[model samples]
Target chain A: MDGWLVDLVAKYNYWIYVVLMMIGFYAMIRKNNLVKKLIGMNIFQTAIILFFISTGAKKGGRIPIVDYEQALAGAVQAADIVNPLPHVLMLTAIVVSVSVTGVALATMLKIYKEYGSIDEDQILERVKNHEP
Target chain B: MNHNLPILVLTFPLLAAFAVNLLGKISKKHVAPWTLASLVLSSVASFFVLIDVLENGTFKYTVGGWLPPYGIELVLDPLSALMLVLVSWVALIATFSALPSIKKEMPGREHLFFSLYLILICGMMGLVITGDAFNLYVLLEITSITTYGLIAMGRGRAPLSSFNYIIMGTVGACFYLLGVGYLYLITGTLNMGDIARLLPPLYESPTVATAFCFLMVGLWIKMAFFPLHGWLPNAYTHAPAGASVLIAPLMTKVTVYLMIRIIFSVFSPQYAFLIHGRVQTLIVWAAVIAIVAASLIALSQRDLVKMLTYVVIAEVAYMVGGVWLGNTNGLTGAVFHIVNDALMTLCFFLVSSAILYRFGSTHFKDLHQLFRKMPITLCVLVVGALSVVGVPPTCGFFSKWYLLLGGIEAGHYGFVGALIFSSLVNAVIFFRVLEIAFSSAGEESVPAEISGSRETHPLMIPSLVVVAIALVVIGINAGSFLSQVIRVAVPSL
Candidate 1:
């Protein structure tokens, strides 16, 4: 029980990310609605960003920003601070996520305008029928 | 003197994309000329950079004066320089050929159209040269967003196709991001060169292997290599002539270049290929299946533009197979095919747009008497078609020869067979189009037949003619191109 608990604690965050990622992937591949697919895409991107953030996290570590005196005194070791690189990377990913969602929404509007519906099957049906 | 050419090649299009937008809001008529002039300028810039890369070898430019491992850097290697020239040249040709269709289809959206077009070019340029993994992802999104915008502006089901593309493209990009996240977790660096240097020790780790899988799978989806190509045909078929002409030629080819970059540059070939014989064989077989299946499906398409998209799928398979051949010949052929495929696809799309412009129809049936009506256009189409069918002294033939040689050298006879089968399939598709267009002369004097005036814009045919001649020129001069550029490029890889 102790070993199991330690293993779970050590790897639980990645497991959570994997679960979220699978859910997103399922919705993206299997959902019938266009908006649901977009949501899945967002969830998918967010899960990845979360995974990166989690990687950068360190227990009992301070923020990446360090005090000048602490640094000058050689009191602050690099490992004592959370790695800031993944956090910075996730910031860019977040921006990309937002932009992608925005473009997707705009395209969904156009799709809705053309088909009068966003349901995947109905849109495919109408498109097959060559309906205006 | 030429140290700035790398940044300049990328910035020219980005600045012009914005400039065209702002400048057009003030004066709509000036937009087209300005866009063309800037393309010319960028093409000149690209040529200069390619020359610089050749003379100076691969050089890295530090963005904003921040050195590598800490900040974004752009590396101008032989592969990126070749792609730089190809993208700018195709964009230049496509822009000129696009005038007729853009005027006919979107009318008032010309500014938006050209701006997004330039943004796509800029994004692809940035994608090819950037050395940082995260920066490549950002540039990829920029390219995808602009591509979605440009694709959505087409008529009919285009918006829906664009929506589908957005979902798939985003998922592909996200998968790539996940791979980067994994890499960052293990290596704590985002610079590709830095990560590469730090990766050899971790090559045996499951984390690194999984990350490689994620990266390749993401890129495979993006390139639409067979099974994942559901979004491509509808998007290309329903697209307005101009957009299809540009997007069809460049998008998949750019993604293939990205795959090569990831394999040779980021992961390093020794680790990517030499470490795993089974994995290489598996990918090579998958590519062979993609080639044969996509070609057969392409042969069944009635719409010319849509058929070409499937052909693009097959071409993607060819490159993927060639690259995975795990030998110098295979890799070099794959790289050389990149340029050859781009130019030929552009020529094909250009001719299709000219025909579409003349007939205002996308159906193969509407091409009746096309040979008699537009002899010049028909001739150009014949050249493009023959090249695609791998007729000798046409550009596609040389690439296929190299690919076949590579396949045999790698002992992947299945891949060689698939290449030959697809070439036969190309013959069927193009020759069928030729028969449909030429077999029946206009017995009833159709209005479009024998116009002799060329209803398509005059500028469009010149572009088509140039591309057609270029196909032959490139094929004939493949020796020089291979020896000077690709040979040097592959050895460095």
Candidate 2:
């Protein structure tokens, strides 16, 4: 039963990542609304963040802090070792992703001001006739 | 000089960007000089790095004195260093040349333009050097955001184009992050070298396959590969002429570099070849479609800049198809073309912008008699156009020779056919424009009142002269240049 649950959780995690990614991609592709596209972009980036953070977690590993350096001076155990590299990397990725999203939103705002609409199709149609 | 030149390639422009943003309001003259100086500094730094890499060997730098796999790492292999030098050289030339043009096009936004320009250079430098997967993401964002800002700063319809670029660039970056996340899940590492080592045993895992697919999709979008290139022509056309000159040469090429890195540095070629066979085939077909579709599309465009933008779409496929051929020759051809195509693109865009500055015209109809009025610039354009069409005695010809050699070597005759078709289409497309340029009435009379009023801005002329010299130098010395720089870089892949 425990093995089955472990398999199920692993399967569930992969499924969730795929589903969220597909939905984000679908929204990005199908939605004519620019703001909605940005929202989709955010959702897409956040799902990846969740995927990375989840990967760093172990079955029963404690928080990644190894407070007792002296206790492990004589001998180290595998159970106490935690993978913190991915966590740190994920932190940086999250920051970068959010900043790009912020910039994209700002660009969308500017687009709205110029075209008076945020719909992609409408903007394209108008831009065709609007000579610079 | 310290063998730590990679830092300067990125740092000098970045610091100047910050300083310019801070000082632009205080002194209007400061921005151009400061941006020029920093780009020159970056160019010299990259040149030194390339020389060292050629004479000695690849050098690695770890940020904060942390070793690889633990802290961030920067690598200076020959290919990347060559690309770095190429990027900075064109950027410096373009910025100096575009200054006067910027004065005319973007009157109040000079400071913002220069700052974003530096940020763009820094982002490309960072992307080229960093060996950490996550760090690449950060730098990619830095480049993407700056690019959006640079494009948004253009005149009419610029903001709309920038918005489209933002939407596409965001999706690309997000897909990359998702790919990285999947790799992290299976391997528990973000360092590319470490991931590469760990991935061999996990080759059959669906997680690994998914990661690879996600990565390829993300890079394709970033590189503006065909069918996925919806945002590019508008972005290139609508951006400031200076921005177009700087970006049209480098951005997509760097994304191609990243694609090479991920395929070879993060996954062994053997596993990739075996497990991703169908994906490679898909990319090759996509390249064919891009070449055909983009060329046909370019033929119909009346606007010169937009037409050139579509031509870039086709050029990108030439490299993409060459790379996807999956032979050593193909990879080498693709890699060689990256440099050749970049130089050619820079040359073309420089001449195009010069014409734009002179006549306030990029439409084919208004550009009648352009060849007669802009003699020197037209000569440069002819040379660049011939190079773009892959004529003999230019860098473009040799690269296409290799790409064709690669196609034949790999038994991909269809790709060979596509290459020939594309080249013919390229020749026809540009020569058709050339005919328009030369055959039009030789009316040198620019309405003396208008000519007297504009004065053509003093700085703009010298900028063209500098880029013209560079185009000739790159075209002439491509053989030795490739051997010295790109050859060393390809092995790391």
Candidate 3:
């Protein structure tokens, strides 16, 4: 039991992300407010971003940049440098998440203007009532 | 210049999108022609790329002279080459009708509309050709964001539908990104080819299997396969006619293409089929339910375009089931159906737009005297309807034939039954509409607003005629298309 607990704790980052993702997914499905849904979406995406960034971490490894002399001589060991690719990839993902939030907020504004409510149930009720 | 065809196919539209926006600020009249010219150039380049790919076979073009497994690469095979041509040409043809439809629908925002439209096309073209897994996610988001913006531009519940799509689409894309991150962590590479090469040794790992599940679920959501298809009907139905004409045909089809890419290119067929036979069978059954359920729901719709949206969902199931059948004939049918369904869906949406252009609604009641008022448009629509019904001498029949053959080969009679059942249901759905339009009772029940024959914009008819003719031409030459293009595109089983 102690060994299993250590194994589970060793991968605590993945468990944190999984818990965060499920929370966001639950809010996205269960929340009535459109803005809350958007917020849930952001949290969901942020968890993924964190997951990606965590993938690049290494124990006792410095940043990815190497000394000029070490790079030219091919003497730098890969194990000593943290992976940079996932961070770079996450940079793009952050931009995507921000753009998605922007679009979602814009769409929410339109929904508010059109239906006079941002609650999903109210908006659905209005739609059902044919009240423009 | 010849070697640059792959990247050039992407750059033309990406550059034109900004140019169109700038030109639109100057004058709205410049937007249509400028967009068309750029797409035409892109189409020609794509055609040449297809020729080159057919001649040389699959080749990768590393971006900015950087080598692969590191820098971004554009992989061009017969499959992607065919998709490139399909996307560019379909956008070109759809634009012909879309310009006039936009003029009637949105009126003054043509420039803004075209800008997003061009960007969406660029994103799809990029999705087809990019070999980098992470790059594909960026392109997918590009495509989704543009679609959300375009759909929100419509009036009356469109914003709500667009909001729903944003939530769903973001989740789908983020899931895909997470899957790619998993792949990168396990394989230490983001290039699809690199991951495929590294995957076989790690196939038994739980992490790889989990990544595969994430990828499939993500793509399934994007493609509107059965259970995850809640966003499609509302989003597509409420979108502006002009935008729907462009999006209704391409978005889901491209996602389906991505699903195929992940299955065959990023992971070998053996891994997807032989090793995971149970999952494959489950997905096939799921697809069967999707087809039957979507077709049944389509029967309940009163709006013409909404009904067609349900039909689109059903067709997506057809492709998903075909590929999951795990046979060459099945994959062939799925790929060929993607081409056919895109054209036919474009046809159906174009006809709806034309109908909406004249009558201001696509409700069945509003369709009275439609056959008389818009004879040419109705004729084209009938051709499209027949194609959807899988009748002979149209492109839809040949692909359905292949899918049926594939289903039988796989001995999944449930899938085969679902196909036949859906076809019959489609025939019923379309013929009911035709009967309403053709019957004199409709004219008698509602007073005729116009005295004589009326059609969509003269320019629109040419494109409609072209698409209708292309459908027949494709059907007649389905044999050649299969042999020359699809056969080559199918990866060895």
Off by over 4 Å in 3: B441-453
Decoy 2 TM-score against native:
0.93
Clashing pairs in 3: none
Clashing pairs in 1: none
What is the per-residue lDDT of model 1 for residues B171-215, given as tens digits with 9 covering 90 to 100?
889888888878988898889999989999998999988889889
Q: State how far residue A21 of model 1 sits from its true place (Å).
A: 1.0
Q: What lDDT score is found at residue A19 in candidate 1?
A: 89
Which of the predicted structures, 2 or 3, would earn the higher lDDT when compared with the native? 3
lDDT of 3 by residue, B117-140 (tens): 999999999999999999999999
Q: Looking at model 3 chain B, which ten-residue stretch has the lowest summed lDDT? A: B443-452
Candidate-wise lDDT, in order: 0.86, 0.81, 0.91
Residue B478 in candidate 1, Cα distance off native in Å: 1.2
Minimum summed lDDT over a 10-residue window in model 1 chain A is located at A123-132
Taking the tens digit of each residue's C-alpha lDDT, what string does model 2 give over B104-207? Answer: 78887788888888999989988988899878988888888889888888867887788778878888887888788789878877799899989988998999
Q: Ten consecutive residues with minimal summed lDDT in candidate 2 chain B?
A: B446-455
Interface RMSD of each: 0.9, 1.7, 0.5
Using Cα atoms, each model's DockQ against the true complex is 0.87, 0.63, 0.94
User: For candidate 2, lDDT tens digit of each residue in A1-132?
Assistant: 999889878678666876887788788788999888877777777777767666666677866665487556945555665667667777877777777777777777777877788888898787777855
